[model samples]
Target: MAKRPKVNPNEMSFLDHLEELRWHLIRATLAVVVAGIFAFIAKEFIFDIVLLGPKQPDFITYQILCDVAKSVGLDESFCYTEIPFSIQNRTMSGQFSIHMWTAITAGFIIAFPYILYEFWRFIAPALHENERKASRGFIIIASLLFFIGVLFGYYVISPLSINFLGSYQVSEEVVNEIDLSSYMGLIRASALASGIVFELPIIIFLLTKIGLVTPQILKQYRKFALVGILIVSAIITPPDIASQIVVAIPVLILYEISIFISRMVLKKERKEKIEVKSITKN
Candidate 1:
């Protein structure tokens, strides 16, 4: 839905602005809660099909890896009948807590577009008509990138981490019995962290709009960005070079895309400024 023009914000007091922001936030929260309710109801689907899928050796990614291994005459490390680790709850309330938080996370992910819409509505009053129009479909693009990142994390990063760390053993005496909270934490962090990380282009767009970044600055810091991506990958994935590289590649691609977004923003801003100057001369 298109956001309607808000009343001129300059006429409103500080309290009024706060009140307006509060309502937008409330609506966004409500949307998340509503989506969360659905997630809670569909616990089987979320936990079984979506969340636990990565733990199974026969998962799509694992299957593909196994197939590639056979084709290359390499060891089929991914083709076990089951994963080596088992997830359990240490506390009586652990299961309930995991359920609630997982539902909430799912809700937030599902209702992300609505939340972004509320955010846009809240800020629309402060923007000129042209600026608002130029930012059309911001929510959609951001939502798409986030969903892609979530899928990537689930399909690639989560699986690889699970396969490697879940199967790794320090000695014959040690067993990999992962706690419910720990397992869920890894999945949650992987998915949510990747989603936020994929917002690089959007962040760059906003920075460019505010004149804080340019194509040249991005190019100049490209090497530094690569280092940052590697650091982030190491933090998110297990201590394996393959998983880190897998996670870092998309982030590097996103960084390049961010540069392009910054360039486009600059081009649009300059064209708008030129039009304004031409109008003033006329």
Candidate 2:
């Protein structure tokens, strides 16, 4: 394979910047497509083991929750032998379409670190040498946080929501025949949403860098952020209090982490300003 030519950002025009960005995007998309093909080939594992895991009674999440509930002398709600719903494909192309999309989603998740690396490469040229060095681990940290969030969603939120929604019914006569698309949609949405939500500290850091966010602002709106986090938890997880609380706890912790990050960023910026001032006065 040939290497990509490096372009000096200082000499690049607006159109040159656009061209550079376009190439970065193309490389990122190609990475996703390649990973997607692999995921597509692993259809059985992807579908039966991963995407459908939350709905299965023998899922690890269910087993763990069952054990926890039993140890606590709580109701055996998580100890069920099976969920009360069946998934079906109502349309002719439903399975095929879902397979393709699920592969793409898996590809994105698997290739997230590469995507972030591409993103960093595109932006790094514009930053000072010190800034680039400071953010050297950006891709790794962001990717790790995202995967952690994805695992939380899959093990904690998805199974709980699947159990609650799949078994829920207004009457004994009302059996749920969930559409295949809907079932997969819930899993995909939960995982991806949580992944993005876990980037809270990164987002706060960038906003602080741009002077749009501060530690005080995050602290002042802590209560409001709590309400928002709860609402987001309710939306992503089952509406039950237990499920919502389980989902909200990590997000609340992330919010606190974001505040600390914002404070650190501001302190760094102030120290830089002071150094610049001292050099100028001398």
Candidate 3:
């Protein structure tokens, strides 16, 4: 295969930059489409084994929760034999539409690393040699954090939310027959949302580098952020305290990590500026 041409930073005009960006975007989209096609081919496994795995009673999250409750000497209500909800398609074309969309979502998730690579490629020309070296592991670290978030969402948030919402009822007369699209939406939302949330530190790092955010500012608004986190948790999980707490813990941890990242970034930037000043004087 022919190697792709590299962008020449100094020689590129505005039009050339746009052309380069267009190709990168095209390549990224093609990657997603190819992955989506594979996901479409694995419809049964995708829908049952991966997407709907959390709804099963034997899901690892439920097992862990059961153990924790037992250790605490609480009621074994976490040990469910079955999830009370039944998922079905109400619209005639719902299943097909969902399959297509879900495949695309899966494709996007699977190809996220490559997408980031393309983004880095676009931005690399604007960075100094030192900056590029400093960010050498950007793709790997960002991808790892994203996958970790995905796992946390799939194994923790999705299962907890499903179990709690699937079992909740106002009266015995109401049957919990969830629509297939609705069920998939919840799983997708939880997983994608968590994946993005896990990028908090990276986001803060960039913002700090660009002088947009600071550790002190983050500290000052910690209480407001707490409220925002709680509200986000409530929106994503069931209104029950257990479910909310389960969702909030990791997010709070990520927020603290973001603060640390901001501090580190600021320190590095300041040190670099001081060293540059010393060299200029010498």
**Tens-digit lDDT track of model 1 for 15-111:** 8889889989989999999999999999999999999999987799988878887898988664677888898889999999999999999999999
Give the alpha carbon lDDT tens digit for every residue of 1-282 in model 2: 477677678999999999889988999999999999999999999999898888878999889889999999999875979888999999999999999999999999999999999999888898888788878888988999999989987888889888999988999988899999999999998899989999988989888888999999999999999999998888888788988898999999999999999999888878999999999999
lDDT value, residue 249 of candidate 3: 90
Ranking by TM-score: 2, 3, 1
What TM-score quantifies how close candidate 3 is to the native fold?
0.95
Q: Model 3 over residues 61-158: C-alpha lDDT tens digits?
A: 88988999999999988788999989989999999999999999999999999999999999988999998998999999999999999888888888
Index of the highest-TM-score prediction: 2
RMSD of each: 2.7, 1.4, 1.7
- List the global CA lDDT of all models: 0.89, 0.91, 0.91
Q: Which pairs clash in model 1?
A: none
Candidate 2 regions exceeding 4 Å error are 1-5
lDDT of 2: 0.91
lDDT of model number 3: 0.91
Global CA lDDT computed for model 1: 0.89
